[model samples]
Target: MKKIIFSVLFLGVIIVLLMQTELGQMLRSGNIQEVAANIQSYGWVAFFIAIAAVVIQTFFPVIPFVLLAGANVLAFGLWVGFGVSWFAAVMAALANFALARYAARDWAEKKMGHHSFVKNLNRHAETKGFIIILLARWIPVLPSSAINTAAGISKIPFKWFLLATLLGKIPAVFFESVLGHYMINWEAHKGKLVLIGIGLVVFMLGINYVKKKKKSTLLS
Candidate 1:
């Protein structure tokens, strides 16, 4: 398990290194406008291309926020872009949820579980679990994909999971979309960035406190 994780991390580093190149950025930026402009010169075909990319994110595990979502908001107004972003993100979370539950169930149980938190999470789901999933979506830093998969293995029913996800993921993405939209107007974006930084620091402190409590319990 550790070996697999290390391999994935190593490959990620290599990919990031490659992506640091200007040429890589040019390609990955989804510069459909420039490409299509070269082909035609008058009209832009970037809209269709971006939507297609959003759909592809469901299968590909790509978070197309900058080029797809944020750019969508910037190009098209906040409402339309935000709606598309929410749909794409929910679909991706759903895909990961099922994949982790049915395909990598045993492996994930061994790796991601093995902790009291995970056990309790499962126990909650064994009874009533939708609330926890909803909370995960409410927290911006908690990846919806992780929450979805964790809930799936929590022994939560598929129907409940689906309903929770559909209802829960909306606000999360909408909030992010608003952030991205506000960011288009640079001054507001700066304030939001500072708030995000402060939020991260608080989150880390909270996590550290929890860890210390757990350690103290072990010592006792």
Candidate 2:
């Protein structure tokens, strides 16, 4: 607990310092295009940094993954950016899983014991582990870190977890990459961007509605 708290505080201090830098200022501005352009100026090093950022954010949960995905697309184009983002997400998930299972074992166990949702996930993991993980990954609003932690503490096989993560991340990463690409190039593809945005909104709404219905049914 002391180590985790210290690490978080240390990270917070680093973030505060970074926010004072020009690059961090750009990030804080939330201009994805400008941030991507700046990061791209560093060439190949930026790719490694981007991946590291994804992994770090998995533990920290400070940076918005969506913005990072968009920045990758702007920096590396559609295909390469999609590949990088997808791979990074996978790596991050695996890292978090390992952390929960090993480094944060006590924390993971405590979280599982305290959270009813996590307990439910653990129960489902005993049987339909892959499906439970797949749905959590497929649904953007679901807390990915918590799910990863819960899965790590459960009896689910690592192979199933890996397979489900790989399969589930494809569409989400693709959506982020395409949407980001089009959004950055909006002047040339305004109509397509609008359609994509509308489609995404509808999809999210439908998912939320289904979740609400499921919750209500369970309560009843």
Candidate 3:
């Protein structure tokens, strides 16, 4: 407990220190281009900084993830940015899960046990855990921290959570990466970007339809 508190405090101190710099100004402004320029100024260490930013944001979430994604895409291009963002996000999810499961599950249960959603999560975790996590990651409307915490406190196996998170995060991460790149160079990729956006909307609609049908069947 003391260790966790200390680590959090240490991270807080680091953030405060970083906030005093010009890079921090860029980050506070939420200017993707400026953030990318700051990242580029660091050369090879830029990747490390980017990954750390993603991981930290998963826990603290003071910075918007989309901003980080956009900055990464502008700094590293689409594919590399996608790879880095996806990897960092997955790692962060795993960390959040581990922290919740190993460190805080008992406490969380005592606190969140009264919530209907947590109760439902507990009930279905063993049976529909993978699908639940997959959909949550795929849709991304749910908070990533919430999903990780819920999965941790529930009966889902680590392997199932890992697989679902890995598979489900792909499309969203890729789309975000593409969106980030297009934001910078939209004039060049306008047609392709529009098609991708349409495809994503159609895919999300199909998933929603399936989910609704499944729910109705369950109710019946």
Per-residue CA lDDT of candidate 1, range 88-160, in tens?
6766666667656766677667766675545767888856677767666776556555576676567877777
> Which should have the higher lDDT, number 2 or number 3?
3
Model 1 scores a C-alpha lDDT of 0.60
Q: What is the per-residue lDDT of model 3 for residues 1-220, given as tens digits with 9 covering 90 to 100?
A: 8646755675575586457656666666767787788888888998887887777678767667766887788889878888889998898899778867776666657765676656776788888878878878867457787888888788889999999989988887887777767766779989988897798789878988997999999999
TM-score against native, each model = 0.63, 0.76, 0.79
lDDT of each: 0.60, 0.77, 0.78
Clashes of each: 0, 0, 0
RMSD of each: 7.6, 3.9, 3.2
Backbone clash total, candidate 3:
0
Please report the candidate that would top lDDT against the real structure.
Answer: 3
**lDDT ranking from best candidate downward:** 3, 2, 1
Model 2 has an lDDT value of 0.77
Candidate 3 minimal-lDDT segment of 10 residues: 2-11
